[model samples]
Target: MDRFLSNTVSRIDAKGRVSVPAHFRAVVQKRGYSELYALRCLDLPAMDVGGLDLLDRYEQRIAQEDPFLQTADDMSFFCHGDGTFLKLDQDGRITMTDFIREHTGISAEVAFVGRGNFFQIWE
Candidate 1:
């Protein structure tokens, strides 16, 4: 129950806010995350959404690589520099950023696909 599971589709409101699935929100709340981190997937047309643990994992992976390598810089830039912090509103919703919309191509609706520790945003 503490994991993001299953999938759901939600409509974006006039203000460009989309409700996070209740179950996914519960998982995030359980982990004491005030905001979710989102990064554009390097190999897919989706956005990876998760909490601090997810960010930590990426940091750990990046730390294992040689700092001088271009791959390390690319990963750090994509995962940290370009990441978006999504703060849930009082209604458990988040306004979609232009970065998210541009990366995911989400229009009026967005699909939330859970992936254990995280979820993916798809158009």
Candidate 2:
């Protein structure tokens, strides 16, 4: 399996599209991830993910062991949001929705951070 890794910063355009730093994209592609999953980060306010299934599975595991009432807050923040399925364009750019942009505090400056099996977008 391939690991996600980042070494550069990227810029997000007015259209909410951000260029995936070349090195990062290469690593993602090598991992067989043509598409990325994005959702707001609960702990880190300005961070979002690019691997939904992995996150979903993690959430499911927690939900199974924890009471719904106890985990409600986290569920609302992590699972109930509008998760986006982002496809990397030919130019190595992905379109972020306004909601996602706002959630991650993404302006013109963006950071692409790798997290083993996925990546995070930070402002």
- Judged by lDDT, which candidate is best? 1
Q: Which residue pairs clash within candidate 2?
A: none
Give per-residue CA lDDT, model 1, range 50-118, as digits (tens): 987888999999999999999999989988899999999999999888999998899899999999989
lDDT of 2 by residue, 57-100 (tens): 65776667545565755565656555767788898888867776
After superposition, which runs of candidate 2 have C-alpha atoms over 4 Å from their true positions? 66-77
Model 1 lDDT on a 0 to 1 scale: 0.92
lDDT of 2: 0.71
Per-prediction TM-score to the true structure, in the order listed = 0.97, 0.75
Candidate 1: stretches off by over 4 Å: none
The prediction achieving the highest TM-score against the true structure is: 1
Going through the candidates in the order shown, the clash numbers are: 0, 0
